[model samples]
Target: MVKIARWNHDGGTQSGFVDNGNCYALPAGQGVQSLLDAGLDETLDLARKVTGSATPVPLADVHLLAPLVPATIRDFVAFEEHVEGVRKSIDGVAGVVPEWYEAPTFYFTNPHTVTGTGEVIGIPAGCEDLDFETEVAAVVGRVPGSDGRNLTADEAHRHIFGYTVLNDWSARDLQRREMKVSLGPCKGKDFANTLGPWIVTADEFEALHDAEGFLPISMSVEVNGEAIGQDLLSNMGWPFAELVAYASQDSVVRPGDVLGSGTCGSGCLAELWGRNGSKTPPPLKTGDVIRMTVEGIGTIENSVGERREAVTRVPARSRPRNRVAPVVTAGT
Candidate 1:
């Protein structure tokens, strides 16, 4: 398996394969995205050639960056246990909605907010209940001349380049308030989404898939150096292929696009709080660190930074008058 990464070394950014605790640099200006765009087979061939020809650098010497700046991000609530747990916590409900079973549901998140492992994530202003969601994400790869739309599950599976550990940081207070209007988790989620220690190419997991195409890989999370929860990827209601295909329905997905496997069962503090009917595992705070790991992929660890004060406030507006008045009958 080839583990791909981008890092800062010798005062500049370099992209390469990481193996045996060493980084083998690709040629100047060539990055993981470029290799992906070149097609998967070629990318694998290049990985071999580059690692063989380049001088190795100690992995600890450089600072790693997010594996790639995603072209788009679509995060899905693919785990049934997560949905049920969170629904119970936030709404005082005990079960998932039927619509969730009909299709894989996803929301587009801010790709611009993507950060690397080891980076500090800041709490948004006015957010008291900060949280972390442990997940696995698939990075899309391009096939030459492909439109990347309305794909079959098999086709979508083939288009996946690699997978990485993800931390979808949340502001629960803001999320609850905004979602009351039934429109958003926007401001609540836009702050940060952490990806990487590095990306593990998808081919590495070929032997791990079950008969149903679900991966049984173990996933776990930690906070402030204490183990929080663990679950298997097989618990997802929909497979990664189905989630990718659902994202492409009547739409387009480009290379570098990311599809997240939402929070795994017992993957977040919010879910645990709901299950226990109390805040057993409390919300994250400034200076708290979160570490998440997927079996085949490496671990991603990040510290929470201080929350910033809001510079401007948005005051509530008065309700608007109805544009159409009721009409009275002539007899009345």
Candidate 2:
């Protein structure tokens, strides 16, 4: 089952569920992680039996926070549709790079980029072309090295703590400009990343299946009341297990870390704009509310805000040792 940590009116946190009309707070520390730790098979069965509580909390009354405060955010470029859409939207990229099909590609985003649902995202100054990416992020449940090496599909599934909805918000203008530099997607991407209203465990949809008999979840997005994105979980180019294996290639994955399945096929700017070689993407502006929904994972709604020029940074110090190194060698 999916689990979430919601804020009470008094600004306190509690475990919750995203059900019919409202969020029902569960017992303390009983979030998706806690439930998975308890037992994936049993916890989900228990979740289905929860009846309506007398005192229910309105979804609006509570703040949705990131399901997992991962130590590091590793995002993978998996879906061909998403990649093709992106290439087509931007000029000059009309075909897929052969290297992309070789294996999964990933990039690291600072963990601090994470924000909760309903929080106002502060746009960076001079950056007007903002965009959204809807992704399904898997939380690492177990510590690495269970088998003393990498894990297979069967072993990897047991390590999944839970799942959550992730919005990899973007600054398209900055991204486009930066693409020419040969560096990774940085400031344009580092600005902000969003997670949960809640987290859903693997067991939640034991019965939900795709046409191929694989477990599947439904996903969709809405912007200012208009439907903009939709897809099924089974359509991912690679499944969670393979993603885990790719992420753990060097034996680096750890618990509480997040692995994002980059934007789903129709989950980003490229899809709507036809990024394969044609189409210009629609830009987001202030006051636009983007809401994303994943079948068992719940919804995350955020609004664009005016860019604020708050440069929160600390000065870096140069080392005197570097300058003295040459002098020391000569003296010696």
The list of candidate 2 runs beyond 4 A from truth reads 16-60, 143-149, 209-215, 274-281, 310-329
**Between which residue pairs do clashes occur in model 2?**
1-201, 1-204, 2-200, 3-199, 87-275, 88-275, 88-276, 88-277, 89-275
lDDT of 2: 0.73
The estimated TM-scores of all candidates read 0.95, 0.80
Model 1 scores a TM of 0.95
221-318: candidate 2 lDDT, tens digit per residue? 88889888788777777777778877776675666678888888788765667643333446787888999998767789999888876653345686
For model 1, how does the per-residue alpha-carbon lDDT over 77-161 read when each residue is reduced to its tens digit?
9999999999988888899999999998888899899999899998889888999999999999987767789999888888888
Residue 136 CA displacement from its true place in model 2, Å: 1.3
